[model samples]
Target: MTLDPEDEKILTLARSARARNGTAEGAAVRDETGRTYVATDVNLPSLRLTAVQVAVATAVSSGAQGLEAAALVSDAEEPAQEDLAAVEDLGNAILFHAGLDGSLKGRYV
Candidate 1:
């Protein structure tokens, strides 16, 4: 499916992060103000977080009242419930799921 240029930008950011960090997944979120946040899966020995969760946390911590959109680049067929909850907590932001090759797979809103 074709996406808006802004949405495509986040997807590219997510895919780049996953490749650069060698993580299982990567995610990016666009805030209501048009600011974007990117993150890879956090797998510390003491704390584990999905990429989408981290992205959402970063956006929130940065004073984003709500999200406009989010992108998740992963091999998983579906995003984790926790990740979805994170985005939902912010607002009704569209969530785009993409494959490693940057192919659009699914969308949630």
Candidate 2:
């Protein structure tokens, strides 16, 4: 990603929103073609740095481990806070993203 200053600002806004909610982690995924894009899951952790900043830093650094290198803030299901908290102590849960293929899968980690 070119990650212009404006892009960094957008990422900063996104990060701030996520952190304030403490509800999501952000990451980018690469397909078989090596074409990569980012997805924001409301359940993952907020990146302290802007998305563009992280992307650029990782791109320039030793390289990124892809989604494995990012933090997970929430589950994909991301049930309503009231709904989940009310139940109390739900077991291990999984989140899925509905892709264009009509499949519920983990699009981002």
Candidate 3:
């Protein structure tokens, strides 16, 4: 897919988070106001959160009213349903999935 500059930036951030943490997943989201949030999966023994969920939380905590788009870079072929639900809570937005190598795999809107 032909990603615009913003989309590319989000994907790159997500990919970098994953690589830096060496974790299962990383995610990034762009808020409606053009703010970007990035996060890696939280896998504590007492609590677990998907990367997408954490990214959405970051946006919310930063006072973003809504999201424009989201990206997840992971080894999984598709994002988990919980991740999609988190994006759904913010608003209707396309969710892009990228491989660990930073290649676009698919998108959910």
Q: What residue pairs clash in candidate 1, if any at all?
A: none
**Which candidate's TM-score is highest?**
1
Q: Each model's TM-score?
A: 0.98, 0.24, 0.98
Report the poorest 10 consecutive residues by lDDT, candidate 3.
74-83
State the C-alpha lDDT per candidate.
0.96, 0.33, 0.95
Model 1 scores a TM of 0.98
Off by over 4 Å in 3: none
Distance (Å) between predicted and true CA of 85, model 3?
0.6
11-103: candidate 1 lDDT, tens digit per residue:
999999999999999999999999999999999999999999999999999999999999999999988898889999999999999999999
Instruction: Please tell me which predicted candidate would have the highest lDDT against the true structure.
Output: 1
Predicted structure 3: lDDT: 0.95
Name the TM-score of candidate 3. Answer: 0.98
Q: Provide the clashing-pair count of each candidate structure.
A: 0, 9, 0
Writing each residue's lDDT as its tens digit, candidate 3 over 4-100 gives 9999999999999999999899999999999999999999999899999999999999999999999999989789999999999999989999999
